[model samples]
Target chain A: MHRMMSDKRTIFLMMAPGFAVFFAIVFIPVFVSLFYSFTDWDGISAYRMVGLHNYRELLLHDPVFWKALRNAFLLGGAFLLIQHPLAVATAMILQYCGRAEKALRTILFIPSIISGFVTSKMWVQILSTQFGLLNRLLDAVGLSTWRQDWLGSSSWAIASIIFVAMWQGFGYAFLLYYTGVKGIPQDLHEAARLDGATAWQLNTRIVLPLLQPVIRTSIILAFIAAFKQMDTVYLMTQGGPDNSTQFLATYLYQKAFSINLYGYANAISVLFIIVCLLVTAALNRMGRQEVGEF
Target chain B: MARANPAMNRKSPLGWPFGIVMAAFAAIQLFPLLWLVDYSLLKSSQFFGASILIWPKPAQWANYRIAFTAGHIPRYLTNSLVVAAVTIFLTVLLSMMTAYVLTRMKWRLSSFFYTLLVVGLIIPLHATLLPNFFIFKQFHLLDSYGALILPYVAFGLPFCTLIFCGFLQTVPRALEEAAVLDGLSVPGILVRIMLPITRPAIATVSVFSFLSSWNEFIMALTYVRSELYKTLPFSLLQFTGQYSSNYAAQAAVMTVIAIPSVVVYLLFTDQITSSISHGSVKG
Candidate 1:
């Protein structure tokens, strides 16, 4: 018994630094953020407790916040409605593409392997107004009138950002679906074929149903990514052109660093945390219930 | 073994369309990178005068030299290396220890601690940004490597630990028991038994943690103030701002920033994919 107790103590000691650092860096600060949200403390100021004022303003009065939230939703919707289907189709195609599968898979995953900063910068260069390839291509095709300042124009900015994000993230979705498709037993497909199912029926009935869990995981991953998106958005536009391209993360950052509204930023972050937790819980719950049904 | 259908073994008649589509998407994926490299060799005059689609005629590789000197890429590169290396080492060590305890130790709160660590994965990184910045300021650690290293390790731990835990669970219990019976200490078993068995897991975690620390931007931007302390990504951003009109120099700087990551990814492509797939499949 004494030996067991000593071992337990050792285990605790072993875990101390990891947990300490985790708490100091992540846990304590998250709570501190929650506490700061209720006050009007700039980073330097001796602030008053402005009790829910920040949240009130953010939730009810802030149009930019609404815009950020809407853009996030739109980005998430695009991932689901656009990127997911395309990834699934590509995965299925690659599965049937015989010798080209390995080469094509690697090609598709190129964007994902590069850093977000590099990819974002590359897109920024591609979208540059004066000497960008995109505009040059448009001009070459005699569609120069169709070219607008992609990153600068308000109407085009959000869409441009979305396109860049989708491009970068497409590889991840493709790989996931590819792995899922590869995992489906060959016998199942063979059995379905012997039952005289067409290729379309084989996909719809056997393959896709098995791929639902992967689809779910990808959607959740993409949604969280959209919600927490800051790097590409910050690098590309910094929520610019009259805040038309604002996102939750970038807005919080601008509030804290650019505008020095630390308290308001903290409020936004707390709300951000709550939204993330709720989304995660809701999605996992849905997964659980679906598994139960299965 | 079940045989795949003979028809399935052959390329489809529609393979051309599929191949063409995939190739087009591949081109889109790779075009910007190609452009970045192509333009990096152009002189300033050529950059301004030439069509964006045109290749460099007289390749002025001196642009890279100017980028290195003017952008101070070597210093930023060193800083990034130090930060990434330290964070990878520390995160892997700590995560292994935590995973060891969670998996092998007979603690009552093992599951609780496991949940605590795993929950870290879902917490939005931005939520911790301001508070950590404030805390670093309080500690007077701002503008130093510690500021970035601390958060990098902290944020990295959850994912690394989870990966280690998943891998550790598959390790046979008998090996650990045998090591203990041989009068090996807990640390001894971790070093001698656990470490070797979990090498692939370590590699996966190391690659990911290294990549995250190396490629991370927002934290580096928030924490570092001095040019001396700035990482490669932050330096590149600054370089762009400073040389916005010098597209060739900017492209050269970007290429310098990009090459290391691209090289690492190419070298560890299989490991990276396996690790990602492993995480998703297990989840």
Candidate 2:
């Protein structure tokens, strides 16, 4: 009992630094932001408590918050539906095709591996209206009319941002899926084959069922990326074209720092946390349960 | 059994199809990177009109220099390097110590401590922006390296410690018990006995820490206000930092910023994917 008590003290001593910073820097600030949300203060000045006015303002009046949340939803849905499915398809191919597995994985992973800021800037140059290579290619293909000011036009700006984001981050999902695939025991497939199950049937019945945990994680990660996306949007659009491409994170940033609506920004953040948690929980329940080796 | 009769059997599920598909995929993947390299050589007119997919006419490698100087890449590169290096050092140090204690010392509060670290990951960093900006301003750390490094370490430690702890869980407790019996103190047991065993986890942690520090831009832009501390990626906004429309200079500066990360990624490519698995798959 004495030994155990002393060991517990040692453990407490060890965990002190991590939680000290975690609480002060992350947790305290987050909860304090909740408090700040009820008050009106520019971040620079000492704040005055306003008693739920910020929340009221955000809920009742702020169109930008809704737009940002709406854009986040679109991105989340698009990634889960379009990007994640494509990632699974690619990962499935790479996994099944043994010879090309390594090489294909590396190739498909290049975009994700590139620095986000660099990739965003690269695409911006690619899609530039004048002196842009994408437009030039369109002109060459005789589809000149297909081009628009991609980042500059409100109609297409959000989609353009989402597309670039998908391109840059698809590698994460791909890698996750690959790991999931490789983790499955070969005996399962061998037994299925011996049982006279055709390859397609084996894949559908076995492979898909096995990769559930990975798919769940991918959904959670992809959804988080879609919401917390800051670097790409900041570099590409700065939430421009009249704020068409703003995500919740960037929008929160614009509110707190750029616009100096500290109270309102904190309000947005309180709600943002709730939304992220709910979405992640939703994906967890929706995604396949991982198989345990035990 | 799996390898012995390959020639006689002549029918393994593995085949050349993977090779062909991977090669084609590799080409597509390398194309854009190659385009950037090629574009640096040509003048603006030739570059812009040419498909970003196609090779350059002359391949003027000197464009890298033109772009570098135009972008003021030296300052941004230096700032990013300093920030990345400092943060990496601090993150590894803090997480290593915390993880060592948590894993090595079996205590009742350890699980609670571990859960506390998750606050960094799940709290939505956006919420902290205002608070941090305010705090940094209060301390006069804004527009300085300290501003970025401190917060970075805070955010970085939880994930890294978690990774190290995950890897540590697999290690049997026998080694430390044996070390304790051999008259080593707790700290000595950790530094000499346990740490050496977790080199792979350390390698994994290093990859993420370094990359996260290198790729961070929003913080760099927000905290580091001076022209001197501009990060390579953020400075690319003005195409060499002067706000000109010079594509060549922008590309050149990008090469500068991209070089270190590319080298780091190439060197640790194995570690990145593996560590990511270590971080996410277990828990």
Best by TM-score: 1
- Residues B13-47, model 2: lDDT tens digits: 64456456656765765666666666666776576
Instruction: Kindly report the fnat of each predicted structure, to 2 decimals.
Output: 0.56, 0.47
Q: Which ten residues in a row have the lowest lDDT in candidate 2 chain B?
A: B1-10
* Model 2 Cα RMSD, 1 decimal: 3.2
Residue A252: error of model 2 in Å? 1.5
Badly placed stretches (over 4 Å) of model 1 are A1-6, A196-198, A289-294, B1-17, B48-52, B240-242
Give the alpha carbon lDDT tens digit for every residue of A1-294 in model 1.
226324867888889999999999889998999999999998786999999999999999999999998999899999999999999998887756666767788878877877798889888878889877788778878898988899999989999999999999998888888887777777787788889987788888888988888888788888888888888899999999899999989999999998899999999999888888887778777775353212
DockQ of each: 0.54, 0.46
Q: What is the lDDT of residue B132 in candidate 1?
A: 84
lDDT of each: 0.84, 0.73
Candidate 1 lDDT for residue B153: 97
iRMS (Å) per candidate: 3.0, 3.9
